[model samples]
Target: MPTPASPQRRIGVLLVNLGTPDSPQTPDVRRYLNEFLTDGRVIDMPAAVRYPLFQGLVVPLRAPKSAKIYQQLWTERGSPLLYHGLDLQKLVQEKLGKDYVVAFGMRYQNPSIEKALDELRAAAVDRIIVLPLFPQYAAASTGSVQEKVMDIVSKWWVVPSISFISTFTDDPGFIGTFVTLGKAEMAKREYDHVVFSYHGIPERHVLKGSHNNYCKLGTCCNSYNKNNRYCYRAQCYETSRQLAAGLGLAPEQYTTSFQSRLQSRLRDPWLQPYTDEVLKEMPAKGIKNVLTFSPAFVADCLETTIEVGLEFKEMFEEAGGEHWQLVPSLNSHPQWVEGVVNMIHRN
Candidate 1:
């Protein structure tokens, strides 16, 4: 008699985001900050140094202030980041159909990665595809997600085939979504210049990951290649380049910058042409009307929605700029949902 074949099993898809506090309250925000800042990849400090510093000084000192920001960020739907991730999870699940099992998790706090992986394990998935929702790869975000998943699943008695989608910055759908959003904003107002601001990482992090000390962190990032392919700053520039090209912008028409650095005198230097500094300088440069794009984020989180949209706009106008507008992020836009589905298929 012929040997029996193994039973069919669905492919598991786990989508992860950076995470948010359980609530906008100070205590909840403090707990969230404690978890987020304590990660070695994030602070890039030794346990002896990182834990005490963040848990004792940073978390306690910043919690109330950060809580106020989170409070402003909170909506009737609660955290935009969490809700958007949930919505994307449902959309991707519906599109992928019954052949795949989809789960959503945050790297830290509630709905943890361990919970998501357990759901997949219960489904007896033959293979699991881990997709960290960050379009660009960074040790602090995407890398943390990958590390957490492996640490959780390594103990499984029967491990399934596993893979990760690291970076999709150059994906047509990713670039096109921003292009569409940017174009919509530009059409509404004639701006003198455009700004592309990505979230800033400490300069040392990029230097630490520098392959054979290849990254100069200057014009070197103007071109992306194998040597600097994984460099976060380079990846940001590449995204800006692609978006600029898609929007038919010349070199002088747009500028690339970084934002949201931890404002600490003790901290190491962060990536520059800092977004705030650039925005303030624009008025003196005679660029009055400005349109900004926070391509670093896919959803309108505190960073994009408040930092770039509200805070930055106020800074621009105060510095004598006439108009400043922020392009919205790709939350549940049909095109972005389709793009994400295509990524799932392609990977």
Candidate 2:
């Protein structure tokens, strides 16, 4: 008789999202904000300056109000972002089967990245693949996730080979999912125009990452190429381009903008034409009925649900707009789950 050989080690798949507070409570929101804001990549400032500025002033002022928004955004399943991530994890796991171990984690709060990595380590995976949920590559989002993963994995005596899917800004499956969602919405009404809005980062961050000072952050982003491959603004425009083409939108039928900026006392520029400002100005231009897309987010978090879906809708209506339709994010949509599985296997 011969002893049976052990099965080969499985690969690990970790899906990471930006995260949410533990609860809608003010305390939980404050704590989450503190951890999120203090990250060096996010603040892009020295610890001395970042801590005092964020902790002393920003978090305290922002948390309670943010908590109220979170309260509105919360549902029976708790945070939509977390639950959706979990749903996607389960679907991706089922699709990958026994060959891979899948886990979900958030960058900031509960089910933290450290815990997710621990699960992969416990599974004794041979290699780990990290997929940050952000489509566009930004130092503040995907970069932070990658850096944190490295910091944790470096501590292990025997580290597994790790790879990251940095950006899927132009992936067909990702674009297709958004297109399907957009088509479904567009069928319901004849919108006057379309707007693609992405999360805004500081202009300085874009300048810092610019290759050879090529990114003026204006017309430079109108065309996407290797020179601005990792440029967040450029990638965003690229996403918009693919999505617009998919939805059968003519170039004149759509426009791009940035949203969800921080209140910078210094008036530091962030990526723009701002979403709110654009919506406000559109009615006067006779673009009253509009369709909006938030491609930067794959899930309906506070930014998508409360800010754009609810808040922006109200703003547009107040500005004399007739119909404001926000195409929902790809939250555990079948296509998106399929896309995630494809992304995992391809990487």
lDDT of all predictions: 0.91, 0.94
Clash count, one per candidate: 0, 0
The model with the greatest lDDT is 2
Best by TM-score: 2
lDDT of 1 by residue, 231-332 (tens): 999999999999999999999999999998986525578988899989999999999999999888888999999999999999999999999999999988
Question: Alpha-carbon error at 157 in model 1, in Å?
Answer: 1.3
Candidate 1: residue 273 lDDT (0-100): 81
Which residue runs does candidate 1 get wrong by more than 4 Å? 1-6, 263-267
Pairs of residues clashing in candidate 2? none
